[model samples]
Target: MTQAENERRGNVPPSNKRYFYRTYGLTIASQLELPELPKAEATSQPDVVVLTPGVAEKLEGATFRKGWLEMGDDRCQITIEGVARYRVEDGQRILLDRRVPREVDPVADPGDIRLFLLGSALGGLLHQRHWLPLHVSALKTPSGVWAFTGHSGAGKSTIGAWLHYTQNWPLVTDDVAVIKPHEDIPYLHPGPPRVKLWKDALAALGIQTEGLVRDLTREDKYHLMLNKGFQDHPSPLKALVMLERAEEGEAASLERIRGVEAFKSVMATLYRPEMGTEFNTAEQLMRESIKLAGKIRVYRFRRPWSLDQMNSSIEPLLHEIKQ
Candidate 1:
């Protein structure tokens, strides 16, 4: 490792406890501590490192916009309005600058900014590292790991929660699924042990709201801790389910997706599409997409918006996965 990497691996001038954590197939070291994630094993080496609190006020080449600006194909600069600014570099290093707002609550914890970093910034990092991050929730079942992908409000998290709480399928990830493609099979990495749920979705499933942490980013949304926790090891991906909301009277059903259509549909679910653009990963993404589509079973899963239909779709979905 280089001197810079050595500094990142706990040789930097210190202020707080440097915490080690694992996620998305990498062991990470971060100074901005988070209590929500499990600590990494002592003997494991870090793949990425996050430096905190002193990231540059503005990146030299950045063209600041509403929230972020593209810094060429290898880097990007993003700000969280009044919270923080981040400079993500080459998929390996992240620099964060935390800010305090004048109107902020005196007791409000500013750590949420770090959470945003882990999500958006990390997504960018994965792209730079040649990993394909998808906007999907995943879980392990007897059949293997199944990925649920869709546009926002298509019930990815709700279904993941349902699979976890009701069907007893252990949660693998929520929101972003980072995949490492092998010869013909891509492996799914476990993410942070948190599930975000809308108030109505939680209520529909009879899950209690008490003591849950509110997601400040989205109104009336709560972050839930999984009872069974996350799978630390990677699991081979078995299937992809593209979720779509059907008309009120339309019954839930699953249909196979094949050939070029499957590739296009799957590509649309990339966690942050522009991240790929930044890395000039289109060619690589195309190759990976075709391989993934050809290897895994892809299905278009349509269901009503109503939660009652969820249970009815579960068994059929499992059966489809088995096939």
Candidate 2:
């Protein structure tokens, strides 16, 4: 192991599980601590074992297993009858897990860690949906894949809810959305399709969902999974909206943008980058992720927003693309 890595693994107790923390994508939030996943024995030394701070209490009699995550989701349980054995594998690689891989960074935080996890998973099972540099939420509308980008308090939920209920569109992602750009073609992958709306918005839409709203940091926001209607829709992206509330009477204008200006705007909504982030390289990436006319555009919307206004505003843009 490198000296830097050893230093990071420092103070990790062999007998404790204190919420292992790491950051991915953007930056760590100044003050947000989350729980760590439980531990399970491995039959073989992991090819890339990440020694996170873990709770010391062993599950009554948990036994080690091979080619699996430590005591995977509840279904992966075994009685601890014997010692678990594992040997590290050769030709394995461990990544530092950067959100913007080639970009520069100072440190990693919990949010960044989450981004890293998603990025790592992108290669294995989620490869088909790997496109663009994205946040957690990506909504699916009847027209195409819709992504809302902005900093916290920018009213993404408000805009998203208005789009769905007022306009009758479906949610793709509430917190995160990945945009996968095709290598040989001009297309982005469809990451997660769902969104979280504020409680008032849910009520306004008259959705009868029952669950623990406590998980939400925003009392107004409720997580939503896209309906089956989006299951077979086109996977390529449609638009990237930077949602922000304006004073009453402010005109909601849709503008086309490119480059670094675009990157910074998109970075704001991402869950990772708790520490916050900025980009010097944005134009090409931003353009590549969404179709110039049909897929991507920026809208400075005003209050009294509704589905009708959204559709009316967006229809012209969509028609432009069709032509």
Candidate 3:
């Protein structure tokens, strides 16, 4: 898409008529034509439709719990009801006149709000190693596409934020990268083009907070939008790094981990949960991801998240990989 075209269609806001909430991946589409988006906080339902290019994945054993809301993006609609979130496949016309949310205290603070939504998220961040979706964080540098992998709090956002801060690199995608494997050179579907890091971490990265969006999740958690006032670019992936955290001095160095061990690392960093995306999707994603790993170098990176450890341990690894 041309810059002029993207400039014409700015970001849409949330609507009171509808809400959007989900854990599945989506493909931003072009056929969507909406009059206007509702002006409200980033709540559950938005009256307007979002455009995505990726295919909508369904969830298994989904149930409508209290405090859940349904969010739709053209090809996908996620009803985040109760503890289990459901991915509704058919995107037929929604009856907005019948739209009714259970109830939520809009004036509540982040922590209290989080309490209300926990059942909706249903311990999303606590999934087992084999269940999480294999999400990718990547950038489009002049040299090649750089992709990073990790579980929640595995520091994918932290590291991706740091790279964007210090180096001024253009990001390809973050949080999710829909893969189309086996094309000789594996490529990631153009994703959200940004990853929101914690504000304190952003400050520590030495990048001034210019136009970042502050998304407050419940409790002590907050995410900062990195694409604030930035542009998007499409690029092919070059290197894939699977991350794992350890004690300050645990990892002696970033070694070339290979064979099943390498595949295991890739599996460990997935982002989607088990209920929404099944084992078959996991196997397919892994097959494509492993192919990418086979073509390019896949490194298992272990590092402490502290400032000292980040620089002393992980910095060297980045330097080594870039070479």
Predicted structure with the largest lDDT when compared to the true one: 1
Give lDDT tens digits, candidate 3, residues 149-225.
76667777777766766677766666665444434555554433345576667667765556543454523334443
lDDT string, candidate 1, 73-111, tens digits: 477777665556678898888887654232554222445
**Model 3 weakest 10-residue run by lDDT:** 92-101
For candidate 2, report its TM-score. Answer: 0.46
- Output the TM-score of candidate 1: 0.88
Q: Candidate 1 or 3, higher lDDT?
A: 1
Candidates ranked, most accurate by lDDT first:
1, 3, 2
Instruction: Give per-candidate clash totals.
Output: 0, 61, 23
lDDT of each: 0.76, 0.39, 0.46
Task: Please identify model 2 stretches exceeding 4 Å from their true place.
Answer: 1-133, 136-143, 166-170, 181-193, 232-234, 267-271, 274-299, 302-323
By summed lDDT, the worst window of 10 consecutive residues in model 1 runs over: 99-108
TM-scores for the candidates: 0.88, 0.46, 0.60
CA lDDT, candidate 1, residue 315: 65
